[model samples]
Target: MLALLPLVILAATPIVLLLTISTERRHALTAGLALTGLVGALLALPTAAAQAPRDVTVLLRVDASGLAYAALAIVAAACLVVIGYRYVGAREANPEEYYVLLLIATAGIVAMAFSTHFVSFYLGLEILSVSLYGLMAYFRRDRWGTEAGMKYLVLASASAAFLLFGMALIYAELGTMTFAGLVAASPEQMSNAVVLLGLAMLCASIGFKLSIVPFHYWTPDIYDGAPASVVAFASTAGKLGVFAVIVRYFLLPVGAVTSGLTTYLVVTAVASMLVGNLLALLQTNLKRLLAYSSIAHMGYIAVAFLAHGPVAAETVTFYVLGYTLASIAVFGVIAVLSTEPGRTSDLDHIADYKGLLRTRPVLGAVLIAGLLSFAGIPLTAGFLGKVYVVLAGAQDGHWFVLLALALSSVAGAWYYLRVVVAVCSTPDGESALERPSVPAAPTAVLAVLAVAVLILGTYPAPVLAVIESLHR
Candidate 1:
């Protein structure tokens, strides 16, 4: 119960601040709330890391996997505070509601990390999804933002319906909603038709969250319409929550049915990799490019889930850490650089970035580093992350999976390199767009993220060790 305090605090902070703070001081209130949440999470770190697994209830538990995910969400939220400092302050819209929604969203993420039952999972997911509807359309003056929000709302609600229906079916068949209880019940207890149909629906719901192919229509539009800071939050933090739940649901009590699901996941992952990267080549907008890239990256991480072993867990965690850092660094830069009054993201066009090195060398360098990491260039964290996934898949005799991943990597290099080319290329003096001014906090955030990415790329041993330690 004590170990769960951090989650409680995280969930409470936003609501508390929203009620207590006056509108005039909302900015400070928001930052203070986030800071409180961060401190609470940090204080719980040692407990979460050292304590044994404990069941809070039949439907929820505290364990190492949840701890890892909670920590990631906390860190990502802290980064959001820094990156959003100026954006929140400068905007003319109501800052109070914006920050309140952000805190609620963060709380929802933490809840998702700790959920152990289908009911709790659905509750956490809806909390996150509902908050995101507001966050996506925070800039209501913009038609694109409102349109994106509406689309996300419709798609997300439909997915939720599918998920709930699946859960009802599973409960009907197994007579339990708790993960442990479900695993304890033999497959023979349920009708094969019900099990298959429920699992397929479950997959569809999660696929929508993960932005996998056939269910990824909302990603590009939402990413392109939201502010860069919000996009960053959605891409990394939101996906991490979904991945945490997926890993827990798939990896528990390892069995034949889980194995079959893993096979399906592998096939979907391969398709996402090829389709996401190839589609990215046609996008001129940076947000859309990264949106597709995110789908591809999810596919890369999905390969680890297909492997199903201690190595798979470690691989997924390491890959997620590297990918999240790269995303934060890239999006942080975009938040700062794209502060134009009306734009959602600065990496709007390759042409817009020509000669960026001359005016914003630090941002250019960070962008280049991030791009290289995404491309899995040697000696980068991305390289090690990719290697782990490929090795894990190959160990399990997933040959076609390995081949598709390799070819996708090669194809991915084209668009990633195109960004690099634009960054390095010199443009005519008059044609060069003047580098926009960025404030101190966002710049500091980018600097920290850049350094983190570089350090992780060069010396990934410590992070890998932490991931490997979760095998127990």
Candidate 2:
């Protein structure tokens, strides 16, 4: 029971929130309650950590990786709550329910992060996916939002079907559905044609979440239509939870799955890097740009999977946490700047931010910092992540894929800089954006994220040491 404290706290938050909403519909009350539960869940991590490396059940395991992923997911939700506070509060819609759905989705993320069985994985994915369908279309008046939500629902359902069929096939052949049981299979069992087909289907589903090439069709529309806060969580914690599961099942023992699957992973990684970056260059909407950029970032991290042992774990975990920090700041800036209270539409287009530096210096600086991080500039969180991914790839002698990563990153830098240059450009007369009054909630979150980015970039040893200790 003690080992389940974190999950228990996280999973219970939405229920408490639902009950509270029935009594009181105040936005502050719901948001405050959500934050309380999320923070409590985060605090409970150490308690769960004390029981680390234990199987809480056949479906779940308590381990260093799970704890770290849970921490990041919880923090990501907390940050989203803060970022969305003003955005949701000013809306006429029932703002209280939004926090409830957010928490439910977060619980699902935590569940998926700790899952060991296919059943648990599917359950968590459904929970997360179902909640997001509602979130993606929360604003009923927005046609684009409704369309995006419907698209997500359809595609996500198809992916779920694929996942279930894959699980059935794998189980039929191996007589087990647990990740451990599958990975522990003999070469002969894994090499079966039926097993390979199932693995291909599974990869397709995972790629959907990671927003990689071919499976990434839904990303731009969702990012383009969803509220900034929702996009923030989906892009970071949502994808991160799935990637956590990937690292667990796929990366642990390099050759444990099959060399064929490894080649498949490598091909997708390279394709995502090249395809994602090339597409990002064509996007003029800030959120859509981020969508493509995220695909590329996932590719970079995927390369980290080439390294085995604790090094692989450390690189992925730290990179994820760091990327989350930078992402929060970037999306938080969008949340603050894009919409005025009571407004239905956001200033999401690139042209809307002309002369942003001169108009809103604080927000501009924060945006520039985040953009630089995306470009993997030195003295930023992204640099550490990029360096480690390169090192990991080099260590494993994946030099060809490493070249793809390097080239794509260079292409990524161009688009990221374009945004930076726009922000810094002076607006002559009419181009200056009106500096709307910003709220304290998102500002505080961005400030915290900014400091975290700087700290992790310049002085990573302390945090890296902690992650290393956990695995040791």
Candidate 3:
């Protein structure tokens, strides 16, 4: 029962918020309730993991990996909710309901993190997709928001079709919906043409959710259209949840039985790295730049995915945590910069950041630190992440992908440094932008994220030990 606690708490959060909707302090009350629910979920993690590898149901598996990713998803969601308080409160007529949607989305995320069966995975994916559709279009008055939402809906529905067809094909061939059943099959059964095709389709659909290249067309537009806080949740919590399932699937015994699948992953990883970074260099918009960078980062994680060894899971976990911290920090700055209601976000133009160091030094420093981490500079969490990726690639002797990763990071550094330079540049005149009054809560959250990055980069042994223990 303790193993079920996190999911129970997450599922109940929206209802708890809905019940308090009539309260006079509804906005503050809603945020507080949502945060409390996330804290409760985090608190339940140790108990959940202590009884390691428990099957909660046919659909859910409570295990170390699930527990770890659940913690990451919930933490990322909590950070976004904190940052979104001002953004949602100002423009939303029914502001309290926004927390309801967020918590509900997080519930889907948690489900995906713990899912062990195809049925559970599809349900969780649809739940997350549906919730995000509403959150993206929350600011319906904006044309960009409306258009982004529609585009995502159409593409996401098509992706779901691919996934379902793939699942159907696999079931027809193997007559199994569970990973254990599939892995138990003989290698000859696993290598059927239909099964391979089905696996390809599944990979494609998952690739779309992770925003890797070729399936990543919707990312920049969606990121640009959505609120910064929501983007933070989508990039970190949403992607990490999907990756959790992939991690489990790859760790299965049958994973090594498919050479064709391994080759397909390698090609896609290289394509994502090259394309994602090249496209990012041409972007002047900060949101779009980060969106493209995320694609490359996903590809980098793929290297670890392809490496079969004891450390593969830990490497992915470390890289993801580093990326999560950097993304949260970057989007936190964007949320703070976006103070106006019923207007475009303030993070759109590169020029907007000029003289930011002089006007908002704290945010300026945070933004630079976050960007540096993203660029894989030493003394930041991202550098450690890249080192692990390199180790994984070398372990697998994947020289081509390793070279691609190196070149992509160089490309990434160029664009990231451009932003840092702009931030330090002098304003042409008295900066026309009004410095938005900084909220203590969001500011404090950003500070914590920045400090976490530094600490993780400086001394990763503690967290690495924990990840090794969990996956061991």
Candidate 4:
């Protein structure tokens, strides 16, 4: 079971390469690669569950947590492939290179999930980050793409430096870089000063990756500048990978060093939630709104993290999985709808959606489902996810955090409902009521996502059971 991990990862390479070979072959290659990766990942799941937790080396470990996150990444990647099929082919960019980068990024995310040591974690992060830089700037001729790439590179490089320095401090104090070793060496061999400083740096570094409050300056610009498909990848898969590592780190018992970290995290979480939602209310562009929305969503996940217990871990994992699925679904709709050649995701403007129900009822319905899920409406996966997170927070006696969450939810409703209202509004122009054509592949993708959202919401037991079994 353990032996199949590397094999599954390697299997994705050939098809990813095929995506770049020629225009005529791009769609088939991308679809094949996505399907192959999904199957390989799913096949590995039972084995991963059956096998005892194994240490591949000091740097890599395969545990239930890692397996869960890897599975989520693979699923999200598969959805993105379907969402991107039409957009990639229509653009002037090389479809093959785009898919190759995506596969490499997926591999990096999986690697990150299984990493047991700082060295492996950094390696996985760098691989994912570098590929994303190119993916962000894939439309090189476009100013938005180029600017977004540059901003991402500079900010990401700075964060990487901080992360390396923090790792060095940790290693110097403990003489080991592995998480297990660090936990074991604490108290007697490690001091509060070293641990606190190291953790602070680590928080700052990861904050950049997760787009948390102070380090979130780059997210909106990048999301607005990049194509919708790339933004989708960054928002869902990239964030989940970082959260997987963050959960592992926080779950470790580091004694007094971690004593007040929960309070600090709770404060940041509330701040992010308030700030992200409030700022989003003012944004006219769809990409920027979603970017801010992503920040707010991360804050909710952080609330679960601050709860700091077995239930917290379970809640966080479930929330991340549900949120990732919903984001992919929402972005898939955006990708198909925002397919105009020169435009970015700005095409998802509220006004652009006016009379969408009249024009494209099926697409409009799918969009409504996705938006309602994001808004945490009843009978949607997002609502269940929020309930779990809020319950975890309340369990931890985080009344203020719970209050902040409630307020943010109320504020969030305005923007999401605005879109729905636009979709149902009367069309003023002739083209406004004209149905937008979505190909069979994208239509099928939307259908699958819509079904998954409903299923996860109505009968969340199966997935929740799987999450419950994933204890460290």
Candidate 5:
């Protein structure tokens, strides 16, 4: 019973907030409610972990691995909500509905993290996707926001369709939708064309969510157009939930026997790494550059994911948490530097940050750490993540993928250094260095994330122990 408490709290919080919160309790009070709920859910994780490795229902499993990822999703959600207080309050928008959607989306993320059956997985994915549609277009007055939301709706819906069709195919072949059932049947059904095709279709949708190659068309536009706060949530927590599902699915016995699926992932991982980094080099728009960078980072995560070795799970978990910390810190800076509420972001261009170090030293330092982590620089979380992923690849004997990761890191450094130089250089004009008002909530969140990145990079043993305990 205690194992399901966090989910109960998450699902109930949005409903209670929607019902009880008055219009007078607009942004601050409503955001406070959401924050309290997320913190409560996070607090419940230890209890959930205590009773872990137990199946709570036909659909859900309470376990260390799921709880760890759920914790990551909850933390990311909390950071977004904390930052949203200022962003939503300043905009000409309905703050109550924003919190409602955010809470609901968070519930979906938690559901995905805990899911063990296809029914729960499909339902969880839809809940998160639908809620995000509203959050992405929260600023209805901005054409960019509305347009981005619509594009996401269309593409995401199409991906969901592929996912459903794939599920149907697998069910038709094996007469089961449970992960355990699928694994049990794989030895006999692995050769079936229907099962193979079904797996392909399922992977296609996951590719879109992670913004891997070929299916990643919507990432840059959506990231560029959405509010920075929403982008942070989607980029961090959104990916956390989806990847949780992917990791669970792949670790099952069935994944080992499906040669076609393994081949498909290898190709996609390599392509995403090379293509994503190459495209980022051509971008001047800060949001778009980060969008492309996310694609590449997804590819890096995949390296650890596909390894399926003894340390593979631990490697993936550490790398994921590390990446999330770096991402939230970077976007927190973007959220703080945003001058106008509903307008297109002020930190749009690379040139916009000239002399930022002189004007806003703290924000500049945080941004540098975040970007360097992305580039896999030494003494940063991102570097540790890359090192782990590479070690996993070596353990699995995936030489081609390892080579791709190494080459892409070099290409990634060039673009990241460009932004660093822009931040430190003299202002191009008087207008360039004028410091924006730094909101306390977001600034504090940025500080926390920066410290977390450093801690995880320097002393990862504690986190590694937690992840090791979670691994099946």
Candidate 6:
């Protein structure tokens, strides 16, 4: 029962908040409940970890890796909540409900971390997806939010259908929905055409959630349209939950699923790297650029698969932590620096931030650090993440993926540096941008995140140790 504390807290927080919202509406009260729940969930992780590597009713698994990943997602969500508190409160008439949706979404993410069955996986994805529908369009006045929400609704519904059908087919062929059942399958079951097609369908739906290539049409629009606070979670936590499922699902022995799955993933990874970078070069919108940047980063993370055993899971998990930290820092900057007064949307163009460095040193510095991290510059966590990914790829002789990573890194740096140069540049004639009276809480959170990026880059042993223990 102690093993379920994290999920219980995550689920219970929202229900309590829902009751509070129904009776009395208070932004501070709502955010307080949400944060308390998340922090409690974080504190409870050690309890869950104490019973590490235990299976709960064949649907959920309590283990070190799941706990760690859940912790990462919770951390990211908590950071967003801290920053988002002011943004959502100031913009919306009824801000309390926003936190409700966010907490519910966090619960869904936690569910994914613990899930060991397709039933749980699908349920968790829906919970997250349904919450996102409201979150993406939370602002009543923003047309882009409305459009983004509609597109997501239509696409998400289709993806859910794909997921269901795939699950049915896989269950039909394998006679089970659990990982252990799949692992125990005969060679004939592995090679069944129905099984491969079902796996392909599953990948198709999963690809949409991760926003990888060929299924990534919704990313830029959603990123641009959704409030920065939500975008931060959608881009990072959302992907973390889905990728956790993928890693667990694809823990197949070599040649168990044949070549098609590899071909699908590799093609999308390479495409995501090249196409994401190439398109980002043409965008002047900061959110859109970051959207493409995420696609490329996902490609780099995908290269972890070329490695065998726990190496792949560890690499992916580490990269996720690094990416989430750096991204939250960057998006936190956006929520404060780029937003117009009375606006919840953060669709600011690159040109709008002409002299961020000269004006707001703290925000400017964090922005630079985040952009550099994305570019894989030395002395930042992103650089270390890329190195581990390269080693993982090399261990399996996946030179092509490495080449793509190298090429994409160069391309990514070009654009990321362009933003950095802009931030570092002095705007002509008119004095540099005057610092607005930004909220202190968000700024403090962002500063901490920036410091964390550098700290992790310099000293990753702690995280590496955790990952090692998971596989031990």
- Clashes by residue pair, model 3: none
As a whole number from 0 to 100, the lDDT of residue 275 in candidate 1 is 87
Residue-level lDDT tens digits of model 6 in 363-389: 889999999999999989999999999
Model 2 RMSD in angstroms: 1.6
- Note the Cα lDDT for every prediction shown: 0.79, 0.84, 0.84, 0.79, 0.84, 0.84
Per-residue lDDT value at 70 in model 1: 78
Per-prediction CA RMSD (Å):
2.0, 1.6, 1.5, 2.5, 1.6, 1.7
User: Which residue pairs in candidate 5 collide?
Assistant: none
Residue 225, model 1: lDDT of 80
Candidate 2: tens digits of C-alpha lDDT, residues 409-459: 999999999999999998658763675678776777787788788888899
Better of 4 and 6 by TM-score: 6
State the local distance difference test value for candidate 6. 0.84
Q: How far is candidate 6 from the true structure (C-alpha RMSD, Å)?
A: 1.7
Candidate 2 deviant stretches above 4 angstroms: 250-255
What's the TM-score of each model vs. the native? 0.94, 0.96, 0.97, 0.92, 0.96, 0.96
Superior by TM-score: candidate 1 or candidate 3: 3
Model 2: weakest 10-residue lDDT segment is 250-259
Model 4, 1-472: lDDT tens digits are: 3644643564456454664475365556655765676667667777776764787767777778887888788778777887787787666455667777887788788888888789989998998899889888886566787788888898789889989998988887777788767668746465568866876788888888989897898889988888788888888898777877776765667442355577668877998999999999998777788889989988999898866756777898888877887788777777788766664433656677788777877777887888888889989888999999889888868998999999999999899888889888887676533544778887787877877887888999998998888854
Candidate 3 residues lying further than 4 Å off, grouped into runs, are 22-25, 254-257
- Candidate closer to the true structure by lDDT (higher is better), 3 or 5: 3
Q: By the lDDT metric, which is better: model 2 or model 5?
A: 2
lDDT string for model 3 (1-472, tens) is 8888888899998888877886554788788899999889889888888887999788999898888999999898888888888877776666787788888888898898888888899998888888888887887566777777787787689779888999998899999878777777777887888988888888888888888778999889988888777788888887877878877776777444367767877888899999989999999998998889999998999888777645777899999999999899998898778867665554667788898878888888889889999999999999999999999888869999999999998999999999999999987685734655688888888888998998889999999999888677
